[model samples]
Target: MLWATVDVWPELEQAVLVEASASVRKIGQSLAVGAIAARADWVAGDATIDLDGLGPADLVSAAYVLDEIAPASLPKLVGGLWRLTADTLLVVEPGTPAGWQRILAVRSQLIEAGAHVSAPCPHEAPCPLVPPDWCHFSRRVARSRLHRLAKDADVPWEDEKFIYLAASRQPAPVRAARVIAPPKTGSGKAALKLCQPDGSAGERLLSKRDGEVFKSARRADWGDTLA
Candidate 1:
């Protein structure tokens, strides 16, 4: 999940990774080595990180390690990490009920801690999808031969669904709306479900000849920002 972000954002090279066990550093190092940009100053360690000694980085990441920790320890952990973020910070967890709860809590805490929403979400406001609903995104992964055999899977591609958050210290981009579902286009009209900045959502229908709006709708996908 994070490797994808590192590939897309050129300025996101320097990274500060914190894990409680610190054993996950091996997996992180493998990804970084596989990356084309190896110039990154990789700083990987346990939870007791020295923010003052190392300073901030372009990216700060805490992966699946967070879900294992105590709920009461979250604020201190996330709050301290927020201050160590320079450009972006990402957190990834499962797509289950527990995962959604963590994401929701972290979302509010990030806003309160003054971090801006970067992706998979359009605004810093509360999430529109209330309980019984959750927001998650999938990254298509190509199945390796060994991977397929281990899982007894035949599909060549798989979508890894996970709840993630990307926040920055900068202001969020100005997006009028964000597409929350795959758009439907037919009969010279387009219909969309959008996530708005006010922490609510609505469906919109536009004619094919509606000019600018129709064009924008045609290009947007399930998780794209609608300008």
Candidate 2:
């Protein structure tokens, strides 16, 4: 069966777009605008409207217009858009894991009202679409749940920052390589290393060199160096 996913109330500001672009690329998904202001060329007449820019009174006006055009189709349309033509729905909120929890609550309410539903899967990686400082109680929730699901399903979880994966069905194996970052300068010079379960030595190198940043580094590089 096909699956539909929705990212509700996504911020369309410049910063949000950059992060979202990276996140969408990881999943191989195309970008589409949810709402538009002033009817631009990129916006479809039937496209969903984002009420964020409008004042309360303007929102009321927009609501009236929407109701007049497609009264009964509102909820279904919104839900369908998020699902992206999937027979199953997957609602996503990447910024705040806590927001995901709220979405989960809404999903529960919908299910209780007879909508088909599934348990919320936490996103393991950071959400590229969210601002750097965007923190939430749901962060760990997504990370832990997604990790367990990926391991149990035998799917390789990507280790990128701020991107989480969830599917209506389990995905195929995708190997994820970890990137161990070195400690900042003034943290002292040490060689970092990784010992495999099979007893193989990994990488050994100094933690940092000047302003350059390394993604993965050895832990042994941070301790006191013996000359």
Candidate 3:
């Protein structure tokens, strides 16, 4: 049925290979939970373990139960059932250097366990998870051009969102990266800016004075700051 299993871990790279291997072997799936708190949609609901302090043992238990129960699907598991299959198991980590290391570690373990491994090739084959409606400057520009070309060609790519023209046929909205301002001491102010991929900007000010205009201008001037 083309089943895909995923193990989400906070610090996946530092996982103990032997322990992971044992858990995977015992679980009967190429994928096993790493240092994750819970399965994709399956919530343990067990308050015995501290959610803030998850570890390997917790991961193993979660994986074991998830693989054993094998819920209908990921969405179905949203109700707290863990589901998995043997077709494809994805051990995903956070998007950090340490996360990459954990992904590699799991990949190594899978290979050593005689499982086929595939790497994400952004250039050759971009991830399907990346939506075309994403609001990255490059992606937005590419979509704009494609929409123009499609219009000229009398194609059926017309959509208000403009994401229908994306080669991946996915929506890609550039989510603004959040920055936490340092705590104010006396009467200082904190501000946040929302900058779109295009040359548009918006801002929020948290001070007595009306600094919205200033913040917006600052955001536009420092468009490349977050990037």
Candidate 4:
């Protein structure tokens, strides 16, 4: 998400990268591109202290870092970050059971802390998906030759799947229904699995007989926000 933030908001003049340990190279990248990699200064043994000195940022990101902390300490950790977030808070986790659980928990905390959801959800209400299922999305990225050779992958590109939340103090723009999964398309019909504004999962079937809506479905893919 740090790399993504550089792309999403190129105008950001300053940023901070929170490290899991005293090692400043927490993110495995350089401090170039105007980011300050800093460790949590206020830490005791097995306890995470509040990072009040770091100050607030326009974009605060906790990327795959929370899984290292105990579940019981989540609320204070999340709430502290929430307080430091000036505009947006991006929390990213793996597409696994534990990761999804963290996403759900942190999302509820963010909502409770009065932050507005900016993506992947349309409202502050409870999540609609129950246990054994979680909300996640995939983004396709081109694989470098070295990557393809190392993984022995057939495709020239790979899908990076993750579960994340984008919350902000500012109001989010109008939302469109998200394609929670890949659309099932047929010769003249398409079946869309969506997470709607009401935070419920529903299937929308569009037939060619419906004309325009069908055309739109044909163009929609997984992870797309459709109107």
Model 2 misplacement above 4 A: 1-86, 95-98, 119-227
Q: Which has the greatest lDDT?
A: 4
Residues 72-175 of candidate 1 have per-residue lDDT tens digits of: 87877777778778888888887666887897788889988778888767777778786676676556889999999999999977887677788888887574
Q: TM-score per candidate, in order?
A: 0.82, 0.23, 0.22, 0.82
* lDDT by residue for model 4 (116-195), tens: 99987877778888868777878888999999999999999988888888999998879778888889998999999888
The regions of model 3 sitting more than 4 angstroms off are 1-85, 121-227
lDDT at position 62, candidate 1: 75
User: Against the true structure, candidate 4 has what lDDT?
Assistant: 0.77
Residue 179 miss distance in model 2 (angstroms): 22
Off by over 4 Å in 1: 9-13, 19-23, 27-45, 48-53
lDDT of 2 by residue, 63-132 (tens): 1122233445545534433334233333344434444333444344444344432222222222222323
Q: Report every candidate's CA lDDT.
A: 0.74, 0.30, 0.31, 0.77
> Of the candidates numbered 2 and 4, which has the greater lDDT value?
4
Regarding lDDT, does 1 or 4 come out ahead?
4
Name the runs in model 4 displaced over 4 angstroms: 22-47, 142-157
Q: Per-residue error at 182 for model 3, in Å?
A: 31
Q: Write the per-residue lDDT of candidate 3 for residues 106-163, one digit (tens) a residue.
A: 4344444444322231111122222222222111123356666866745434322111
